[model samples]
Target: MSQQSVIQIALIEDDEIVRLAISQRLQLAGYDVIECADGESALSLIPTGFPGIVISDVRLPDISGLALLPQLLANNPEMPVILMTGHGDINMAVNALRDGAFDFLEKPFDPDKLIETVGCAIEKRQLQLGANKREEYLQQAQGLDQILIGSSPGMVELRQQLVKIANIDTNVIIYGDTGCGKELVADCLHKVSTRSQGNFVALNCAAIPEALFESELFGHEAGAFTGAIKKRIGKLEYADKGTLFLDEIESMPLNMQIKMLRILQEKLIVRVGGNKSIAIDVRVIAAAKESLKDNQGFRQDLFYRLNVAQLYLPPLRERGEDILLLFEHYVNLANIHAKPLSGLDEKTLLAYGWPGNVRELINVATRFGLDASLTVADILVTKPLASIDSSASELSLAMQTQNFERKVIAEALRTHKGSIIEVMDILDLPRRTLNQKMQKYDLHRADYI
Candidate 1:
C-alpha cells in the first residue's frame, strides 16, 4: 500500500465512529485504507486490480456485506476479505468465513487483533500473488529444453535445428511418425521465431472434411452459402504475420493442396463469396507421417515449396535414451500426488514397443498415475492393439527383488545421463559397491549415456 502502490484495505462500514476508529488503527500500523459508507458504493467503489484486502461490516444499509462478498471476489478471487460482525452475528460471521471471508472481526473491535489480522492477510496475499507471477513468467519464458522435455542427443540436435531456422520465413515441413510431436515441434518453431508475438494457427488436414476444408482454410463472407450467416476468418488470414501449421498435410485434398501452394507463393487469399483479395503474410509449417518427396498423391511443386525447412522428429523408440525421462515427465503431469514410477515400471516402459509413440506413452502414463493399484506392466498387458514382454512380472520373489535392484540402479544411471558420481550420490552408494552392483546387473554406463 503506497501513496499509490498496491492498496491494503477496503473498509465498508456504515457506522462512522467504528469505521474512523478502525481506519486510525490501520493507518497507525502503516497500512492503506479505502472507506465506503455502504455496500452499494463498494460494489463499484473498489477499483479493479486493487490487490488489497476487503474489510466490511456484516450489516449495511443498502446491501449486506454477504451479498457484496461474492461480487468483490468475482473480479479477483484471491482478494482477502475481512468482515466485521456484531455480538449476535457470531454464527453468521463463522458462516461468512466458510463462504470465503478471509477472517471476521466481532464489533467492539480489538485494535491489536485488527492490526495482527491485517498483517497476516497482507502476508498471505503477497505470497499467493508472488507465486502466481512466478508461474506466469515461467510459462512465457521457458525454453525448448523445458517445453520439449528431453536431453538425448536426438532431442538436443532437434532443438538446435529449430533454433537454426526459427527466424527463417521459408515454409517448413516436419516429418515424423504419428504421435511423434510434430505439432509440438512446429509450435516451438513459432514460439522462438521473430513472429512469436503473432498468432500460431494449426489445422489438421486429415480432420476436416473435403467439402468444408476450403471454407475452413479461407473463411466465407456473410450469407455466402447455407448456414453462412456472418463473415468468417480463415486459418491463413488469422495467422497473418505469424505461423500456419498444417498437420497431416498428406491428407489434404488434391484441389485444396493447390490453393495452399498459391497461399504460400502469392501470400494472398480470396474469401468464398467476397471478390476482394486479402493478402496474408504467414509461414507455413506442414507435417506428414511419410515422405512427400516423390509421393503420387501430392503435387511436386507444392511439395518443393513446403520442403524449404525440413524438420525430422525421431520416433520415441529411436530415442531410447529419453524413454524414462519422457515417461516420468508425463506421469508427474498426470498425478501430482503420485509416487515415483517404480523400478519395475521403468523396466516395463523400456521393454515395450510404443506402437502409438509419445501419444500412447501419455495415455499409459495417465492410467498408471491415476490407478494407484496398477503398475506399468499391468496397464501394458491389458492395453489393446499393443504387445509387451511382461516376463519380468512372473519372476520369483527373490528374482523379482534382484531385478528391481538392477532396474533402480539402471534408472538412476539413465536419469543422470550415465554420470557415475551423480548416481552414486543420489543412491547413497560407495564407489566400489556401485561398481559391483552395475557389473552384477550387466548394466553399461555407456549404454545409458
Candidate 2:
C-alpha cells in the first residue's frame, strides 16, 4: 500500500522475538506497525479511535489480551482486535471472540493468513469511517439540532424521506405508537420547511372538551359563546403561513371533524359569531397513535384529505442498536457521570422491548445518571402483556411458526448467556443466518446475558 493508504497495526506481545517477527512481516506487507511489549503500554499508546486494528497475544505479562479486549472495544466499538493464542488455549481465544474480539489466530500461524485477515479488517474499518464521515457531513448540512439520533436502516430512510418532503406543501399524517416522538418529527418537518419563519401551533384534540372544540380550533368573536369575553384567535389562524400540528386526531369529536374538514377544503375559516370569511395559508400535520381506517368515530373523507403524505415512525424496539446510541445521547444531555456499558448492562439494554419507545428510554437514562448503583432491573419497568386467548388455533400457521422460531432463539440465547458460538452450535445455525434472524426479531446477544 502507498504511504497515505497504509493501514496501521498495533502489535502487543511480551515476547520480544515474536513481536519483532510479526512487526517485520506486517511492515514488509506495507503496513505501519506499532509494537508494544505489554497490554499496559498498548493501552497508553493506542488511544481511543486509533486509526487501525490490534494484534495482541492472549497471554501478556502485565494484563491478558482477553482482559484488554473490553477496554479496546469500549474506546471504539468499531475497532477490530485480533488475538493470538497457543494451540492449548484455543478455547480461551474463542471465548475472547465471543466477548467482542474481532478474530483470533493460532500459534505458528501462516504469515500470509495473518496478512489476509488484517487486510479484511482494515477494509471493514475504512468503510465504517467513510460512513461516519458521511453522517457527519449530513448532520452539518441539515443542522445538528434537527438530526435524529439513529443509524438503523429505518432511521436512515426516514431522514431521507423527511428531506424529500420538507420543501413540499402537501399535508402529512404521522402514524406511530404512543411516546414514539411523533411530535418531534412534526417539529422537524416545520423547521425544515419554507414556513420555518412562522409560528408552529400545536394542540391535542383529546385534551380539549367537546363543548369548546370549535372555539378552541377556529377561535370565536367576543360574546360568541357563554365564556367568550374577548376576541380570540383560533389555532388555525394563529398558524397562518405556518404549520399546525394536531396530536391524537383520532380523539377529535365526530362533529368537529366535519368542521375541520370544511376548513381544510375551503382554505378559509369563519370565526364563530362572525359572517366574514378569512383566507388562511397553513400546512397541517396530524399525528395519531391508532389507525384511523374503518373507525366509525373518524370521518373517512377527512382522513383521505390529510393522509396525502404519510410518515410511519418505527418503535424503539425495532430500531436495533439505536437503543444504545439513544441511551448514551440522553446520558450526555443529563450531564451525569456514567461509565461505558458492558456485561449484563449491555445485554439488558439490547434485549428489552421498549414498549414506551424513546420516551421511556430517556427516563431510564436519566435514572441511570442519577443513581450510580442502579441495576438493569431498577431501570426496566416491564409492561404487562395484553391478555391473549389460550387457543393456538386462533393464530395462522405462519404466525405460529414465527413465534416458535423466536422462542427457540430466545431460549438458546438464555442458555448460552450471550455466547454467539455456543448459541450457534446449539441452534445449528450459520453465523450469517443467525444474525439475520436476531435482527429481524430485534434480538441482541448482549441483552440475553
* Alpha carbon deviation, residue 376, candidate 2 (Å): 3.1
Number of clashes in every candidate structure?
0, 2
Off by over 4 Å in 2: 1-146, 381-449
Off by over 4 Å in 1: 1-142, 386-449
lDDT values for all models: 0.79, 0.78
Error of 2 at 254 (Å): 0.8
lDDT of 1 at 436: 52
Kindly list the per-residue Cα lDDT of model 1 for residues 1-449, writing each as its tens digit: 34224556888989999889888888877778888899888878776666778899888999888888988888878788988888536578768867888777787767887777776667556645644543444345457877786666888899999999998878899999998899999999999999999999999999999999999999999998999999999888899999999999999999998988887788899999999999888989999999998999999999999888898888887786377777766776888777555445555666666767898889988887888656676676565532432442232455456666776887899899999899999999996468656644446688778
Best by lDDT: 1
Give the C-alpha lDDT of model 2: 0.78
